[model samples]
Target: MNENLRCADEARTASVVELAQELIRRPSRGGIDPYGPVLGVLEEWLDARELPHRRLRDAAGAPVGLLVEVPGGRPGPWWTLDACLDTAPYGDETAWTFPPACGDVADGRLRGRGAADSKLAAAMFCHIAADLAPRAHELAGGLAVLLDVDEHTGGFGGARAYLADPHAARPAGVMIGYPGIDEVVVGGRGLWRATITVHAPSGHSGSRSTTVGAVTRGAHLVRLLDAADLPGGDDGSGFPLPPKLTVTAFHGGQGFSATPDRVDIHVDIRTTPGFDAHAAETLVREAVTALDTALPAPLPTAVTPVAAWPPFRLAEDAQPAAALLGAAAKAGLTVRAKTAGPSNIGNLLAGEGIPATAGFGVPYEGLHGIDERAHLAELPQVYAVYQRAVLELLGR
Candidate 1:
């Protein structure tokens, strides 16, 4: 068990670190983004290594993602390792102490936009594949490394597109490299988005006979939703997950004088397993309809479903989770597991019934905020966890 997965010595470690820095230097917004200088650099690196892979493309011939495969000498299920390629936009240049795209390694940190949110782990996975390629015969199964875009913007188009690609490997299990180094996230909250549109006859604010103003009524509905006792209320008797409801956007009244006739209130709700997106929508519509009884005159209201995605949860007995926990125990690292928050890709996989999926990676802070950073020295430990997890899950 002491067989170290930190196979990269000083020079190799330096090389991987350098590659990660170079990747951070390039800016990739998302799948729809036309600018992808990072992809070119990655392609060159893969070419030099002569790795077997494919560029997943959309119908219009645009690159959505890259899937690299290393086949094992023996037969076993394929394990898909993922780290998103697209990094969130660096908010303000002046806010950053170190230049966001400089990819500087200073103050004991790899400082850049994607330094933690995950270009580092992506680099580590590529290097791991290089290390494992020559020793493929020793592995009991094959491996596919997926570096994707379309995660940050919540489209998850990269994963969806790649899943449809005929050449893409159908992963028997999956691993995502995210921030929390000392944690292995087991699942995430689900999301439901909808708009409540109100249609009422317009009138002058001074002479309106309307009992409930459009904006005021919308506000009232917001309070109702917030106060409603939804399931998964941290009771500890259930799943220990809480429901989330928020009025993201409210539009009504123009020029601030005339009594507004139409109003639209947009809401984004997060749900747990017992309370799903569909269930949330139903409850909201029913409550909205019930509000009519309290009104002096019924104002027609419509609740339109914008979009929805179910939450993802992996059972404790799932193979990928077991492999990760076992490796962590062997490494003597205390790692906690829980469902963190809202996610798109994990939900997609979980909805599709893919339970053998888990997430773990190097620690970092300020995700989607200023001055994001992660420790290069910690890469070896985390890499060891990934390598061990892979071997434990895919090798046997």
Candidate 2:
């Protein structure tokens, strides 16, 4: 390696690790901790570097995240690099070998909650933006770093705010910095999430009278849902995976004294391009209708759709995907493109007709679980790959 490039990588290593540790120590668990302190640390870093950045907020004026952009001298399409600063709640603090916010760099791993799931990527992208700022005039297109604080909460307020901004240029493509070095996530199965309310006659359990309870009806419905068939694998839709359904949550009943009148079931269906959200909803509704007919509830079961996102799969030659994949090869890394089983922000962007490459970074362990940490041994290589990809996209 050239001396200058080696020095740059070393500097990036120190900066990224230091910043990631600082942010991790602040504990910005999504919807749990206030975003101010964590976002403040990042903003301070940007400010120190004199990078142009701004805070994104939701409709209620809550800070959603931060956006940093380095515009080029010439006009070209904008590209985005995204990573979430918010983290999943630390499941059991006592179960952790170290503090959830330990921020330790022992055994070649950065130990912490958001370190893997992605505060480290957030730190890396910030430095990438800073690196581009000096040579912004030499590039063709611009680079944007989106540090999302509302990601793990499922609100996606940060991405929404940025896309909704009238003045903000629509990104040509987006690369979400989710961790996992083996594959670059090019697409994901979209989801149709809904709540089903099962109704039954409420009565005192002691009174008997052969009254059917909501619990009984709900249990029956669960079985029916489980038996319901989804589209089998590879329906020739160009997507490799098939549709899936899961009854995620069920709530009903109180003390044994009384039979509950209503039960709510949360259903999550993973959709593919061939069987989209509408198809999933239809299948679910059919199951509910069958339940209503056989069980004969006091009122027909209610199926209310809460959220839906259409599935997307980027072609191998697709923009951003091609650029990133090529860059990885150029970096002498054999990273393959993958379609994740679970939906991500990439699905959301696909809804707006934007393509994205998600989940390419350092290897991780215990993501969203106990002892979450990102292995730092591959940090330099991962960093170099992304840097090369961004530069290639920017036509540098």
Point to the candidate with the largest TM-score.
2
Mark the 10 consecutive residues where model 1 has the least summed lDDT. Answer: 1-10
The number of the candidate with the highest lDDT is 2
lDDT on C-alpha atoms for all candidate structures: 0.76, 0.92
Please give the lDDT score at residue 129 for candidate 1. Answer: 86
lDDT per residue, candidate 2, 1-396, as tens digits? 699988978888998999999999999999999999999999899999999899999999999989998998887899999999999999989999999998889899999999998999999999889888999999987998998999999989999999997867789999999999889999999999999999999999989478678999999999999999887978888898988999999999988889999999999999998899889989989999898888897699999999999899898798899988888888888899999999999999999999999989999999999999999988988888888889988987
What is the alpha-carbon lDDT for the whole of candidate 2? 0.92
Candidate 2: list runs displaced more than 4 Å. Answer: none
lDDT of 1 by residue, 225-269 (tens): 777777656634245578788889889899855777778989898
The pairs that clash in candidate 2 are none
**Residue 117 error for model 1, in Å?**
0.8
Off by over 4 Å in 1: 1-7, 31-35, 203-212, 232-238, 295-299, 356-358
User: TM-score for all predictions?
Assistant: 0.90, 0.98
